[model samples]
Target chain A: MSTQSTRLAARFMVAPSVIVLFIWMIVPLAMTAYFSFRLYRLLSPDRSGWVGFNNYVWFFNSPDFWLALTNTLLLVGGVLIITVILGVLIALLLDQPVKGQGVLRILVIAPFFVMPPVAASIWENLFMHPQNGLFAAIARGFGAQPILFLESYPMPSVIAIVAWEWLPFATLILLTAMQSLSSEQLEAAEMDGASALSRFRYIILPHLTRAITVVILIQTIFLLGIFGEIYTTTQGGPGSASTTLPYMIFKQAIVAKDIGRAAAGGIIAVILANIVAYFLMRSIGKHLDA
Target chain B: MARAASPRRRLLTTLAAWFVALLIFFPVLWMILTSFKTEASAVASPPELLGASWTLENYVEVWSRSDYPRFFWNSVVISVGSTLLGLAIAIPSAWAMAFVPGKRTKDLLMWMLSTKMMPAVAVMIPIYLLFQQLGLFDTKIGLILALMLMNLPIIIWMLYTYFKEIPGEILEAARMDGAGMWSEIAYVLTPMALPGIASTMLLNIILAWNEAFWTIVLTTTKAAPLSAFIASFSAPQGLFYAKLSAASAMAIMPILILGWFSQKQLVRGLTFGAVK
Candidate 1:
């Protein structure tokens, strides 16, 4: 067969998967957009009639909506702050010529491999248990009151747990970018009496900007849908302190069985995530094309 | 001129780095240590690290009380099954996109990736309703399909990147020699890209294994994976600390071992194309 025919065959082979992805992406999202304007609760299916924009109004009018939106922003912002700073620091540390570097790298990445539910459970049970947790025990030994991490500061606690999971990813990506820096440049800086801080700030940070963008983009995609950690850790509990958009959506749809309101909430969450993702994609697209 | 000061600073930096690494690893170590302690010792006031009498009772009780083997097998089936199915679909698609470039190839790839950016919960209700309607709510196959679809984009993206690294001339050479498309991809392209393919498969398996949302929501008792198994111990009233740790250990051990062995490949795969 000629190359043209072979290419045609390849295209034919690829079409099905592409179509599947397209339908998978479009249908549910269209349903979500449609339901956002309707009045359809799962429990009250018979009484459900068209109440256009009422669901969205009801959702936006609720104080819980604003609270959940704020929580989502805080969760995303807080986790990003913690992960990026620690990621760069750890990336710099791991980049040095040190013994057992491989093991240390593994130790750092191990948390990322851990299932979120299991990680959250471990943090809650083994690390954050007020009675038997390591932190509690250490606190008592130091003559301090045992701090209930999730209970007292639900959002920050969730943020910390998630940061632990995501920091390695940022570190790995940034470290790869760091290793690509030409050693000659660093050597030149050193010969010119450039201090460590100067070299890092002037040379290293500039080199890592693209990698940082990629890390932030990728991590935001995952963080926007962060359900397991919040569910397993706080269940959005202690009076909905840790309930982010995704958690709120889950509770509205699954627990409350208010499908229309949940659908509206889902649409809002998608809009919020996409707004963040749009900027991220632009940066990533520039980096990829460059 | 500054060698003496540089050496001292280097030593201090190395010490600080090790300290931070230890701090990050401390929780996992603590969990493992707590697993070996008795319930009383695990929760002891002083939090004895090395002084507690080690016991295997937690592991034994955890194993006996739950069908751990079933959960383990479920996890293996779902993760491995999804990964294999994903690769089976992704390889051909990636091969086509990488070699047979068309006007819309990049657009198609980007479109596929954009699907991943949508929050899973946005579709959660519809999927749940569909699963219930189709009678697939609590089955291994349901979980497998969900995970496969979830990870397919990443698999295809990684494979596309890997496939792009291979020179197109190599496949052209095979085609010129009268080899068919199947032979060109199966016998030539695949063997050359085996390492990349292997790493992609490994990473996808880990992702599928670690997935918690759909697994927890979709499965109940029969097809619940280790994530669900560990979560069952989180009772509001129960204080099963030792057993919880043991269950956690059991849940994490497989992936932990996998991560330990494949850390190099994982790091490389995750950072693929980022530096370049």
Candidate 2:
């Protein structure tokens, strides 16, 4: 099927996308790498100097660095746990011969389509608000004290919002994967008097491994940059309690005008991401026949 | 045939699943219901379910007070424009890689997918600085280009997976005929691959539409999509509950409908086609 002209044309055809992505990756990355070494503060626009990793030193030495790193990891880890666990349960339920499956599935996937800002604000004002939120209302109705969600439990609250947004994504993906499972296998085990738990353990769990891995990896990529929801809801507030790495970088660069420091933080994030990406790239590429 | 569940089990499953689904979807549902309430009733304790007098006043006020249409228009142009542009570049690129095998093809595909893993914040400074320097900041064209670049890999990956599944024999058969390259693609590939292409386009548009990070950071006013519009509520405002709900509902309604319709492709798109 591969002719000489077609082969040449293949290289030619793939060039534009490749070149654009290369520039997208390399140029800003190079600038970020270069600037991370130089002391470039936005406040004093002309005071650029060769800092020789001073920015990295300062970024690491700063208290927010480690705090933000922990928060970042926890946010990713927390949301991944909540969403993937609940997503699996929901997918399993949806995979059953339930009534109104179409409507139920639509309701399930609705949250994934809502923009982050809307989701956060809806939570902030309507669900998580201390005085007047739905939770507060529910608490008051039960003759209990209304809890301050974002104020007292900032990290968990932020995790909740982000998990809500991503739960739909995991469920949608996992549900599709579950739908693709061969029903005959499950029925075969059932015919042999295998208990439901045993069937799930032996067949369903094994089949869902790939989808689960894909969910974790892909969600990890987006979860590492949990910014908008935090920005809108917590603003990484209550003394930087919910300040994830991305928000920390944003604050350093935009709010503090510390470009070099932010660039260093950016570098740190890139290294961390590539660490995750390394495994992901290997897995996805591991199975291809060509 | 598979044995059917007992009626009682089906009822129990339906009840349990619906309860959980509704619980998960409650925030969005509550927002929609709240949007129809007056300012006073919206924040009412015990959370009026159907007790409040329904009114369109909030929607009317939101539409008149804010530039809702402008944000809506920008969201449309950015999502739709970026998607179409992505399709143009991706279709050919995916075609080349899928039909013509190279030793590095899988490596290249993996590399491209890895691009999606790069956190946007990692390159925030340079892109921000460059956009400011080129006067591309806070403009629709700037956003369109940034988002298009941002989502290029997904576009290519989705199209590649879709194209790869078309069975190479079909294209080979087309080649065996007297058809030239142009017709081979235009007639043979286009007609057959249109559904996959359309689904890819749909999922990409949804992603771009809901994209918050770049949309919020890159543009301040002129190019601010619904993301920024909704983010404006973060600042403390007086008695904005109903209006906030109204705006939130408006922001989510279109994509919610679109997402519900094209969910299958979204699964394939997000999983790098591994799941489907």
Candidate 3:
């Protein structure tokens, strides 16, 4: 058989799954676009009328939208910064020949496997509770009033929790990258009388650029849609202080039952995600090809 | 290359690392401890780390109050079912892309992955509406289907990465030997890529098991997984610290055990191509 025909046959074999995914992606997206243009609300059936760009106008005009956007950015940025910094430090530590390395590694990665809801609930009930939490107990031991992590500093608390979960992931990636570093290059630098800082800055950091970028990109993708932690922890509470885009969309759709506004929020989210994803994909795609 | 650090420096660094590890793990550890405490003891000031009269009463109460066994079984079935179904579909798709040269293959893969980036809330309304129309709401089959679809992209991506690592000549050799497609995949490819497939399955099962939003939104009592089971404990009441902790611990222990056992595979799967 010709190569072209063989390729065609392979395509045929792969078509069903691809087509299903395509429909799944396109249909909901198209519906969101349609709803974004229409004036539709769940509460009023008669409000289903053609009102192009009205939902977007309201969303763009609303202070809540800007607040949610800022919160989303803060959450994503804070998580990335915390996870990458701590991940590198932890990876460097674990890379050393330490006792009980296997156990330490397991302990480090354990948080990533815990379900988001479970993690959030554990934090809410056991670790961050104002009166009875571990932190509160520690505060009380020092004769301090218990401070609420979620109520007073909801976004930061959520960011910290998310960073905690993702740090292990970043560490695992960075550690794997660290392990694959060529010893010859390091030895060469050392023989040339390079200091540890210089070696790391010049060689190690460059070697890690791709891995770190991958970590940032992938984590950003997941972090943008972070819902469970925020929901379980704060429920976007204390007067919408912690409501990110995903939470906003959820509120519009599930709580308010306004399909149109929720759909608009959904479209905006897609656009925002695509913008980030496009750049990340381009960089990672080029790196993979190379 | 070998400047030995001082003992003090080594100890400080090691201590710091352990402290951070312990800090990150404190919540889970605390939850386990809290699960054993009475409600009042759970909320005690200067919390008793060891002096709290330890009891399994909370566990017995939570276990008897909720249908935990049923939820556990539902979680197992949905997670395993979705993972297996996703693998069944993904293996072939990934195999085709990895082995065949096509102009759109990369684009197609990216598109599928992009679908994952679209937040679930974006499509929640339509999905809810569709499920209601189709009478799929609150059904295990519905959840299994949703999870399989939700996780299909990651499965294919992981499988594609794994399949790409195998040389094409091996599969070509099987083809030349008159082994059909089924035998080629089942007899040759499956065994060669078993590790990757295993990791993918493990990761998917974890994801499905932990999935909360859809499980909570879609299913109520009958088919809700541990995620929903845990969420149900969160009430408007002022506090239910011990019960919540108990529920959280129960929900997490099984997956936590699974995670502990498969830590290596989880790490490798997560960092699949990041290192290279």
Candidate 4:
């Protein structure tokens, strides 16, 4: 199995994927690093020159940077808390001996399939619009003034929409993990006079810890760079209320056209993501060995 | 625990589960219902759910007035094209890793998974510059390549997990019969792994379809997929509720169907096989 010729062929086979991924990861990253040290604005390309650490300084110094960082943390934290808690509950519920389980699973998992922009717009316009949205209509039905959801609470509004989109994913994964738990274990515990609450706390919750961690890490990787939901719903607005790190960098690059500073911000994003990836890879690596 | 429950308890659980599912599904349901209403009736006071006058006018208008078909076609091309490209590259690699173990295989897999953790915005500036410089801005090919790379890790991880379940002895047996490598893969391995390959393709397609960041950033009009096309409706405009609903429904319906089919595979795919 470890012959020379077979190993040669295996290397040849694996080369393309490895090589392409290497270039995909390294090349743009190098370019981002290169441009980050130089002063280059998209609007005025002729006045370009290297300015060591200036872009980083400018990007880090901005109050918007801190705001964006806080917003990013809040967005990730909020979505994780919501999705994990609700995901566990819904998954536990769905795992019950319910009638029409297939249809119920389908209904619960539908939101994860909707495209982000569609999800955002549907919520923003149809559900959150103050004047004519469904919520407005419901409020008016009770003779109460309609609350302008995005206007008043942009971060929460975006979080709720994102949570809706991601709740299905968490539920699906947790449910899969739940199904793997042996029913005999719970029954045995019941015979030992364990109450339902204690059974959940000891048996069910412990069983789901790995699945919950997987959900959080995977969701955080995607959530840190959430763009479409904010872009479609709030536009990072009522004056940067919902702007996360990625959206802030996006605005710097696309809207502000300051290539150098944007590239610096891009590097910052890479560093931040790598920190999370370090922990995620560790967990997955342990799982791999197990 | 499958304990014999009373009828009332069984009925209670069923009702509770159904209630949560419907509550979660209500927004999509509302969107679909809104699509059939007249523009005026779509925003009617107190919101008519069932009483609104249903019509096909919004669908007709969305089809005719906007570039809906082009966007839909663009979505189809990019998602399918990227997923196919990803599979082509991933299959050989996954095959190698699964059958031919090497000292670095685990490291290689972890490294590949680490690449997925690189936030897209980190390279957005450079990629955007490169795309503009190469005259690939707003082109489907550019997006196809970008998205292929973005999702390449998941594709490889999913295919690898699937391929691992395939017995290496079969390939060794084929080798013992003097079958060539390509023949073994083409004839023996391909048939055995077809179901896994198909599921990988399905999950990849669904991911590519709903991919928002790169699709929206890279393409403007000509290559704008349904994701970007739907994003265009963010601007406030009068009398667009029905049209927006129609467009949103069309964008999500196909993938929603595909996603439902691929739910089992999705947990593995997205989690990099960290979760079963």
TM-score of each: 0.95, 0.97, 0.93, 0.97
For A148-231, candidate 4 gives per-residue lDDT tens digits of 899999999999999999999999999999999999999899899999899999999988878887898789888988999998
- Report the CAPRI category for model 1: medium
Give the per-residue lDDT of model 2 (tens digit) for A1-290. Answer: 78899999999989899988988877898899999999899899988889898999998898988999999989888999999899999999989888898999899989999989899999999988888788988999899998999999999999989999999999988888788789888888999999989998999888888788888888998898878898888889888898989999999999998999999999999999988777765775454332
Candidate 1 vs candidate 3, DockQ winner = 3
Global lDDT of each model?
A: 0.82, 0.88, 0.81, 0.89
lDDT of 3 by residue, A2-102 (tens): 28776777887688778767666678677778877787776788858878887888899989999999999999999999999888878877776555667
**In each prediction, how many residue pairs overlap at the backbone (N, C-alpha, C within less than 3 A)?**
0, 0, 0, 0
1 or 3: which has the higher TM-score?
1
Clashing pairs in 1: none
Comparing 3 with 4 on DockQ, the higher-scoring candidate is 4
By DockQ, highest first, what's the ranking? Answer: 4, 2, 3, 1
For every model in order, what is the iRMS? Answer: 3.0, 1.7, 2.5, 1.3
Fnat values, candidates in order: 0.54, 0.83, 0.58, 0.87
Q: How far does residue B182 in candidate 1 sit from its true spot (Å)?
A: 2.6
The better candidate by DockQ, 1 or 2, is: 2
Looking at model 4, give its docking quality level: high
Q: B1-276 in candidate 2: lDDT tens per residue?
A: 125999999899999999999999988988999999998888776778668878999999888888988998999999999999888888889999998879999899988877777778878899999999999999988888888889999989888988888888887888788788899899999987999999988898998998889987888888899988788665253277988899889988989989888988888888778778
DockQ of 2: 0.73
Q: Cα deviation of A284 in candidate 2 (Å)?
A: 9.0
DockQ of 1: 0.54
Sort the predicted structures by lDDT, highest score first: 4, 2, 1, 3
Candidate 4 chain B, run of 10 with poorest lDDT: B231-240
